[model samples]
Target: MKSRSQDTAIHALGIDFVELSADRVVMSMAVGPSTHQPAGILHGGASVLLAETAASIASEINIAEKNKYAAVGLEINANHLRSKRDGMVTATATPIHIGRRTMVWDIRITDESDQLICISRCTVAIVEKR
Candidate 1:
C-alpha cells in the first residue's frame, strides 16, 4: 500500500505511517518544536490527530475492496497520560468494532521508552461514495 504521508496533513504534522494492516495500524511522529505546545511538551491535539488518522485509515482498509466507500471520523476522544518532551512518539491503532456502518478503534500513543503518552478512541462512519 502507498504511504499516506506524502502530502496530507499527516505529512505536515511530520507523521509517518510505519505499519498498516487489516486489523492494526502504526504511526510515529517526532516530538519537536512543531509538535510542541507552549509549555514545551507534545501537544494533546497532535496526539489526537495521529490517533484519528490511524483509525480512519485502518477503517478504510477494512472496507471491502469492491465497495466504493469512504471512512469519515464521526467522533474522537483522547486522554493525555504522560508528557513527552523530545524523541519520537508512536501510536498504535487497533479495531474495537468493525461493523457495516461504523467502526471504532482504540489508539495508544507511547514515547520512545514505551511509556504511555496518550490513549484515544475514534469512531468512523462508513458511507458509500457517490
Candidate 2:
C-alpha cells in the first residue's frame, strides 16, 4: 500500500520503518554519535519519532476505505527504562484503541537484543478528509 505520511522510509524525525502490516508495525532508526546530544546515547526525541512513525503507519493501515487520517500526535507519554550506546533501535507498535474518532497505540523501543529502551503511548485523531 502507498504511504500516507509525507515522508520516506526514514523521516526528518529520525524514524524509519522496517516492517508494516495490517495488525502490527515495526520502526527503526540509528542511535550513534550522529544522533546523540553529546552524551552518546539515544536521544529522547528519537524515541518519540520512532513512536510517531510506527503508530502513524498502524493508523494508516487500520483506517476504512476512502478514509484518510493524519496522525497529529494528540498525546505521547514515554518512559526511558534503559539506554544503548551505539546501535539501531526498533519500535514495535500495537493497537490500543481503534475507535471511529480517535485511535491509540503503544510503541516499545528496543535494542538489538530486545532490551526495552523506552515505552510510549500515543493518541491520534481520526478524521475525514476536509
State TM-scores per candidate: 0.92, 0.84
**Model 2 segments beyond 4 Å from truth?**
1-9, 66-68
**What global local distance difference test value does model 2 have?**
0.79
Any idea what lDDT model 1 has? 0.92
Candidates' RMSD to native: 2.0, 2.8
C-alpha RMSD (angstroms) for model 1: 2.0
* lDDT of the candidates, in the order given: 0.92, 0.79
lDDT of 2 by residue, 45-121 (tens): 77887787788778877877535555456788899898778888899999989876778999999999999999999
Worst 10 residues of 1 by lDDT: 1-10
Q: What is the lDDT of residue 91 in candidate 2?
A: 93
